[model samples]
Target: MSNSALIERIAARGDGVTGDGRHVAGAVPGDRVRDDGIIIPGPNRAEPPCRHFGKCGGCELQHVAESALADFVHDRVVGALAGQDVPVGEVLPAQLSAPQSRRRAALTALRTGKQVAIGFNAAQSNQIVDMRECPLLLPELFALIAPLRDLLADIAPPRRPVKVKLQMLDQGVELVLEGVKAEGLDAAMALQDFAGAHALARLAVDQGYGLETLWQPEPPTVVFGDVTVEVPPFAFLQATTAGQAALVDAVTRAIGDAGAVADLFAGVGTFALSIQQGRKVYAAEGARDAIAALMGAANRARALVATEHRDLFRRPLIPAELNRFGAVILDPPRAGAEEQVVQLAAADTPVIAYVSCNPASFARDAKLLVADGYTLDWVQPVGQFRWSTHVELAARFSK
Candidate 1:
C-alpha cells in the first residue's frame, strides 16, 4: 500500500488527484494507481449505475461512493476558500440530493433520416448520447424522452440539432422545443394531440423566431414556500426539491431573526419568497421576467416583499442603501457578485447570507467581505447536481 500511488482527492474537473500530483481519469479517492497505470478499485469507488457513465455529460461522479461523494462536495468548498486564503469555518455535513430528483433539464436532440437521437451531449463533444435510461432526471421528465423522439421526427428538421427543455412545474411537465418547426394543420394537430395525451402543463416551440406557445392548459407555475409564481419559459430553478430545501434551510439559519432582509439577484424569489414571512424583504433582480413574476406572487400573497428590476452588477446598492437592511442574502450567478460585494463590504449590514453555485467565485467574494471585518461564520455544502462536479452552498457572514 505504501508503494502504490494513493489517490487523495477529486480535482475540480472530476479527475482523481494522487498524493504525488498525478491526475487519473475515472479514478476515485482511496483508489490506488499502480506503477504501470492500472487502477486498483478502492472502497470509495462504486460501480457506475448508468450505461453512459463515461460518455454522457450529465454526470461525472456516479462511480464515487456516497461517503466519498459527500467528501468531494465538502472539499470543493473548503479547498476553494483555502485557495483564496479565506479562513474556513464550521462546515456542516454535506447534503446530497437523491437520484432521479432533478426537476429541470435542457437536452439536445438530432434527427437523421427516419431516426431521431436525443439525450445529453457526449462529454466535451457535440454528439448526443441517445438516452436509453437516465438515473438523474425525475421519472416523469425522463418518461417524455421516447415520446419526444417520435414527436421530433415529425417536426424537427432533418439532420439538424434541436434543443429540448423540460421542467417539472406544479401543474405538470413544461416542455419547450427550440430549433423545431411545426408548420401546416397536420403538424399543429400532432402537437395538440401529443400535449393532450401527455397532459403537458405547457408546450411551446421555437421555429426560427421566438418561442410561441402551441398548447398551454394554464400558466405554468412553481411554488416557493406557500406562494405560487407563474414562471416564464426556461426560468432558472434550483435543480432538485431536496437541494432547494437544503439551501433555503441554510439561508434561514444564516440570517437568523433578522426582521429586515435584502435578497440580491433574487431569481423568481427562491430565497426572498421562502424567507419573507414575519420579515420585510427587498428583492432585487436583473431579469425583467423573473422580477415581474416575483412581484406578482408577492402582491397576490400580500407578503412583505418589495421587488425591483435592477441589475446589481451595473447599479449595486451603496453602503447608505445597504445599511437599511438588517441582513442581506446574496445569491449571485456563477461569476459571483463583485460590484455588490464591494458595496456590501463598506456597509454596516450586520449579517449576510451568501448562496453561490461556484466555489471558486464565492471564495473570491468571501475574501472581499472578510477584509472588511465580516467573519466567515460557516458554510453548508449542497450536492444539488448529484453525480456531477458542480457544487452549491450557503454561508453566513457576520459583522
Candidate 2:
C-alpha cells in the first residue's frame, strides 16, 4: 500500500492518538486535521454555550473556545493564500445573538412512530438528528419545535420530514412549513388545532402533509444600524446577526473617501442603506422582492439610493458603467464574481471591497485583480457561522 493512501484512511476520534501514528488527535471537536497530519482543537471546545454541543452538526466549533476559533480562522485564511502578498487583518469576533436568534429557515425529519423531530442534518450526511431545541435558532423558534414534533407524530405520515421556516419581522413572527403529506380531512383539523394552539398569524398549507404554516401574531423585523429591515417569510438574508454586522463594517471601511458607491448583489440593502449615510448609493440585485423592499426602506430613510434588478452572475458591470462609480462593494454568492472582477480590474474605479462566504473563489478572483494592478489591502475573516468549515471573509482591493 502506498504511504499517502494509507494516511488518508485514518479516522481519529476523541482527542487522542490511535495506536497508529497516522492521525494525532487534538482537543478541538469540529475541525482538527492540519496538512501535517496533526489534529487541532475546534473553536468552541473550551466552552460550548448550547447544550447540543458536539452532537449538533450546526456548530462544529461548539467544543472549542471562541477566541481560539478566531485565531484558527485567521490562520486558515492566511494559509489559504499562502505565498500571496496579501496582508492579514484582524479576524473579527462575531457579535453573537442570543440563542434562538436565527430569523431564517430550515427543516427537520420526523422520527417514525415517535412524537419527536429529527432536527438538522447529521454530520456529513442528509440524515436528520432528532433534537428538541436548537440554541442557535431564535428563542421564539424553539417554542414551535416541540409542538410541531407532536403535530407531525399524530399526523398519518408520521415518518415524513417537515420544514420549519421562521422570519421575525417588525410586527411578529412568520412561520411556514414544507414537504408534509396528509391523507384526508383530518389534516385540516390538525392544521387548525396546531395554528390555534400556537397562536399563529397565518396558517396556510402547501399541498398535503408536506406543507403547513404557523406564525406569531405579526411580522418579523430586524434592526440594522439605524434602519429596521422587515423580512418576509420566504426571503433571503444573512442567517447570523454578527456575520451581517461584520460584513457591513468591512464594506463601509473599504468605501473610505468615495462619495458615490455601487453595491452589487445587494440584498435588502443591508450594506447599501447602512453605508450610504454620506454618499449616493446604487443597489443592483436580481431578487424583485428584496430590491423593492430595499428601495422603500431607502426612501423612508431619505437616503440617496436607486435599485436595479439584474442577475449579476449572467451580466456584471460593463467598462463604461464602472467609471461612473467612485467605488464598488460586492457581496456575491458562493460562486464569487469572476467576470465582475475582470471588468472592475479593467475599469477606472479607484477602490473595491468584496464580501465572500467562499474563500477559494475569493482567492481566485483576488488573484485576477492583483494581476490587473490592484493591491490587496486587507483580508479580514469573520467567524459568522460559528460551526462547520464554512468561512466568511471581506477583502479590500485598491487601484
Q: What tens-digit string does per-residue lDDT give for candidate 2 at 17-89? A: 2334434433442444555565544433565676666566676655556555565566556655654544444
Tell me how candidate 2 scores on lDDT. Answer: 0.67
Off by over 4 Å in 2: 1-55, 83-101, 154-156, 182-205, 208-220, 300-302
lDDT of 1 by residue, 102-221 (tens): 999999999999799999999999999999999999999999999999999899999899999999999899999999889999899999999999999999899989999988898889
TM-score of model 1 vs. true structure: 0.98
lDDT of 2 at 299: 74
Candidate 1 RMSD to the real structure: 1.2
